[model samples]
Target: MIEQTKCNAILQKEAESFRNTSRRTFIKRLAGGTAVIAAAPYISCGKAGDSFEALKESAGALSTGNIGDEAFWREVKKQFIIDKKLIVMNAANLSPSPVPVMEILFELTRDVDRDASSQNRSKFSTLRQQTREAVAAYIGADPEEVAIVRNTSEGNNMVINGLSLNKGDEVVIWDQNHPTLNVAWDVRAERYGFTVKKVGTPLKPQTAEDLVEPFRDAITNRTKVLAFSDISNITGVRLPENELCAMARDAGIITVIDGAQSIGAMNLNMHDIGCDFYTCSSHKWMMGPREAGILYVKKEHITDLYPSIVGVGWEGAIGSGTARKFETLGQQANERIAAFGKTVEFLDAIGKDRIEARILSIAAALRDGISKRVPGVEFYNPQNREMSGGIVKFASPEIDLSDAGSTLYETYGIVCSVHGGNFPGIRLSTHIYNTMEEIEKATEAAAGLV
Candidate 1:
């Protein structure tokens, strides 16, 4: 274990670099949020006397080698509070928070419950803006361009509602986009009388060019926004966002991307990504609170797009009005949302570059293990590492996987989820905390089921 406590310090330093870049507006919101965190009661993770020992303990744990270095991953496993009897392979559904994030959650909840101040009431908005600043930096976007939403559904809704196209305008969506996001567009399209074009993304495309052509082919004069999941949750395919965005830009079409699978798992820059809008929930790979999500829109589009829920003066550019307008439904898990700052801090500690590399390393191992175990496992995502993110989809031809997937966890005490979508499979996802051993264990059990 390598004590990246040094790395943690370095991460904070790097995060400080944002101080110069952050908009004055986001800084004010974050400062207010930090003040709230300061007033919050301190919940001891352990005895006060154990602080040094805890540091030493953490230092000892950090000295571990590569995650697959079996000895190292075992210790890494200790930070989580998962059921010892059950193995959790389903990070896609939700990941268990590590000690650090949990500690933050515990403290924040205590403060919100203990105090009745304007600070706590207003801090929710501030915390979200701060979180967006960090996330936007990680994803290569400006803080002003980002809005903290509840989930991918909410973020997607912002884009769907913001778009000001006419009744005949068309938007492109993949058949395999997450149901919540895909359906949001469908519901709005019907209401606004716009055309919802389902571009047929093939299960296994030969190359990046092949994977993107479906959307390109569907473009028409009325096709105003070309949107798709950054990486389809069901198929586990990483779409070419920059390429598609460039193509759309040439045609005067805007681009919207669902980063549910891509955002935290991969290092994405919104500006470099060439998309006009992007949406992702923090819970999944970001490992933040479930109801907290974010939306990014190009600065120019903010004025053009309107908020869905209109009431009580909701106006500003992207994430304007402290992003309060989008919180149409009132009084949220305020503390949980604030705790998202801690999640971002942890990720910042690990380094987004390290995390991007770490999760993909685990994903590759699972892909190899699943393929070797079941030759007939349908590999829907692009085989190229660059074309996939944290998700790896595989279904056995010899077994009825749709039904068998649920059993993979229930019987084996391994946690995972089954997908019945464009490319049916046992959708296996992993995050920073997931080691190769767990993936191997989950794979072995999955192989047995097949």
Candidate 2:
């Protein structure tokens, strides 16, 4: 491991270089940044104390290698609390919380249990605000623009229920949106008498425009909202969110993005994407605790959407002034909410650009190996890195994917999902914690099943 003072010196020099560059150029620096490990030594004083210090020490030893190095990722994998024997690839559904996050979660929960009084748990209110700030900074959003909620489903429903849509109003959405984002609109339509339109996305898209043009063609004078996922949970098809959001703005239509799959899987700048509302769950890719999520409502639209559930601490005439107006849903799991800060710190320490690069590299390796090793396999995911994130879906007509998934798990202890959708196939999600060796293991396991 690099010595603490020497590591600090190297990082101070890199910090000067980064401070002089634009965000776009800094992303290149961040992707190629050697300072993640160089700077890790300085975080030895992180809130979790020695446990986080040990993680920093491990990271410091990994500064010399590039982001894709196995030696580097093996150190990262150690930070997660998981069974090394099992090959788990279902990051799109859920992931194990990192050690620091898990540690703090347990500590706080025990503290809450020890003293269940109102004054004893009051500090969490400040911690919750700190968590909101951390999350907002991570996503390039303002602190006031974010609301801490239960999950993506709650955030999506908040928009679906709160928006002022009347009879004959139209909502345009993609067919591949998750059930919460796709069908929830129809349920609202049934009550409010609005028209819901589903745009058919191309099964095999050649370009980003191909994904955007369908929504462009589907918009009409009656269309009041344009809602879709930044990346589909079904086929792993990534939409051109910036262009689509721009199109919606030009048409004076409200835009909401179901960001369930994109948040921690990529280097996302919510402000750059410029949608009216966006929602995501921390458990999926962010690897935070379950039943905790974030809702982003633009500054101008805060008043336009009402709070779906009004509970205690909701002041009527005097609004909460910011996104907190939407967050007054009564008591919460203070322990899990407090631990969100630790999860953000963990990801930020690795650097978001580095995480995105590592995930894409592993997913690409898995795709190449599977296509080469397995015969008669058909890929439903977009191979272009620009049009995909970490999710990879594929199928073989000769093999029943459900049976293959079961056999692979039962025989090889490999864990992945056989998804049911328009594209019925296997979905493999690769995250930063995953190694190239695991990718090869998963690919070889599928080949053996075939």
Q: Could you tally the backbone clashes for each prediction?
A: 10, 0
Task: Report the poorest 10 consecutive residues by lDDT, candidate 1.
Answer: 44-53
Give per-model CA RMSD: 7.8, 9.3
lDDT of 2 by residue, 330-404 (tens): 778977876777788888777787788889888999999999988898887779999999998988876776687
TM-score for candidate 2, residues paired by index: 0.87
- Regions of candidate 1 where Cα sits further than 4 Å from its true position: 1-76, 119-126, 311-329
In lDDT terms, which candidate is top? 2
Q: For residues 97-197, what per-residue lDDT tens digits would candidate 1 score against the true structure? A: 65555655654565455555764456566566666677667778777676666888877877787778679999888887876657878888878899889
Stretches of candidate 2 above 4 Å error? 1-51, 57-68, 316-318
lDDT of 1: 0.69
